[model samples]
Target: MAGTTDSGTGEYGGTGGVAPDRAGPAAAPPAGTAANPGPRRSSWRYIGPGIVVAATGVGAGDLVATLIAGSTFGYTLLWAAIIGCVVKISLAEAAGRWHLATGTTLFEGWRSLGHWTTVYFAVYVVVWGFVYGATAMSSSALPLVALFPEGPGLKTWAVITGLVGLVFVWFNRYAVFEKVMTVLIGMKFLIVMYVAIRVAPRLGDAVAGLVPVLPDGSLLYTLGLIGGVGGTITMAAYGYWVNAKGWTDSRWMKVMRLDNRVAYITTGFFVVAMLIIGAELLHSSQIALTSGDRGLIDLGTILEDRFGVVTAKLFLVGFFATSFGALIGVWHGVSLMFADFVDRFIRERFGVDTEDMVEMVASGQRERSFMFRAYLLWLTFPPIGLLFLDEPFGLVVVYGVLGAFFMPFLALTLIWLLNSGRTPAQWRNGLLSNVMLTAAGLLFVVLCAKQVKDLIW
Candidate 1:
């Protein structure tokens, strides 16, 4: 009841009588206050959460998927990659909008839908985190293993990476986290663009790629490219980052939208650059990359052979940045979501009088909340065992199915929440927003169906 509002004015005025000691210090002055006047313009300087989300979203798997598409279909599916970024921009914007307009976390909005959402998300975060932790660590470890063959083995590096991420996230606040993510993103951008340019992409053909075309037998890759470019649950995490950044109300809406667009535009470049590398370097030679993170290691080896040792080493460093950035991003972002989930669940089920979700976020208590640290540890430690053992086949299937459904779930639910009375009318989705979200929901639904079908059969 703390964050509930009947006025629909989209402003959260107070902390609903929660004790002063529990509320902690407000992490930021309320929007429009003298200490925190809303931005006069949507400046690039306001860009933080978007970069974190983009860097986190485009992990090694995304890069590999885009690379494989280019290797298989050349530049024919390039239009789909660009469209994917556009679609994600809409989704991230919508998520951030919901938070600012409603003065609640996305999980709070999800809980408003039904008890069933609670059930679904409870299972999803647990299973998804367990698997993803191992996966993220392994992905981050691949480049390290490749770079220092004489050093630790894969499992060792994975454990080391996990601990490093945990320590980094545990000790740092949002400000430090954002700074580190930004630095890593810079490394990733430079290396990816360098490779894209160094490949001397056929300018005429790449430009031609802007036009939509589906080559014969290219349907699946086209779909994957569209649905897969820099899309993930972290998109849902964008709002939490917005709140963490101290942009806690509708006044910050313009800044959020600008940040969201810059995020995907950067993501589009990453996807396109990887595509260019796959097309120019691997496709011409009929070389195939092994799927998943190993494929990047393969690309690094190829870069060494073709460019020189320094270039290859730089690419490996970039790969590490991409992987580890995602590792910490999720460690921070999803843990925030999980903390909010537990907070809301306790308040609802046990009738605990907690601070408003916006208050929790803005007061910085959310980051230091017990549930937050618990989930952070959940994301880091249990998965280390997974690194040593083979992931059970059944668990893998569950993870894939849950992962597949998440995007559609996010898109369709946003449509429900934003279009309903829960959000301020001015903040609701417009015609173009509806169209894009509908398209994204359908695309992901198709992708989900295929994934489940493959898992079952």
Candidate 2:
């Protein structure tokens, strides 16, 4: 099926918007056209897909989680961070594979699994967004509101941030939005790298940290480290992004492999950077970060006290970018998924109003799905109530446990789906890939168990 043109007419599709072209030269590029794109040209775009995935994968919460691990256990837990990136990379690649091989939205895949799959996500997205939205804004606000004593209270800043992000997401095309995200992702990398450089770990300790050593009685923190590296509900959003990237058909298998590999490599670097900083500077320190998202704010304060106001400010600025990127990423990516889900639901319920029943192609029907922006609004605003309260332990624990479990769920599913005959033979996982992904799933299961225990006990 790869490298062959389909008989059906094609449409020009991208992160932008889609337009059909039944008779024009814009026919779906013959699978071979994509197959034979010069290596140099293909390479440039490959760099891009990875960046988008990596940028979205890292978030403020992941950083804080790494920081806390460092402060408490130092380099002892570095193995978990390394393990984390591997698991996330495997899971994310699998999601991308599903889209490329199946030509189906992940939502559709989940539905096929059972009504329960749909019900789980339906419940999860809303609850997760409600708590996450306010949390994201407050984390972004921490640096600004803290830096400018006269800035609006956290809630006010949060609202402004939400509205501002909403406007950006609502108005911009995908290309423009993705470019903006890439730039912010660079900023995050710069700040994280700078911190790592400053921390300067002992060569011996750093090497030792890479060797897995389960510290006595600290099984919980070990799992936390593995789970925290780059796991999120966002892991499931990879399929939608790949769709935006124009890799929808099986023709793009080779490119997809290169793309997924690059994406997770970047993800791994982002995680390792945090572990380096934590092990070098923060291990065994008395500085305890509060469990809330606000802990990143406390990190900035610590940075400011030790490195000077400018350093603190830099971390804050990075925090804002990281949190806001997560906001916009969720806004743009997850919303796309949610919108598709809603559109599917509507079509299922109302039979797509015959006039509106234009059959949905792999790339069509995206704009009709408003689940994207609606979710952005939900993620940015409702969580504010939690900000005023104590960040209810029940919900936080719920978020942690669910969040921990999601990566493995995504991985194991992909392992099942992709390893099956469903994916193109060329794109299917080899024995080595299966072994690596299986390990990824096992690692997450361990992490999930730790989280469930923490939540229950």
Give me the displacement of residue 403 in model 1, in angstroms: 1.0
Task: Put down candidate 2 lDDT per residue, 84-171, tens digits, no spaces.
Answer: 7776766776776667555566765666566877677777777677776776677677667877778688778887777788789778
Give a tens-digit lDDT track for model 1, residues 132-191.
999999999999998999999999999999999999998889999999999999999999
Weakest lDDT window of 10 consecutive positions for candidate 2: 15-24
Which residue runs of candidate 1 sit more than 4 Å off their true CA positions? 1-30, 34-36, 353-360
Question: Which has the greatest TM-score?
Answer: 1
Best by lDDT: 1
User: Where does candidate 2 stray beyond 4 Å?
Assistant: 1-42, 348-350, 353-368, 384-405
User: In terms of TM-score, how similar is model 2 to the real structure?
Assistant: 0.84
RMSD of each: 4.5, 5.6
Count clashing residue pairs per candidate. Answer: 0, 2
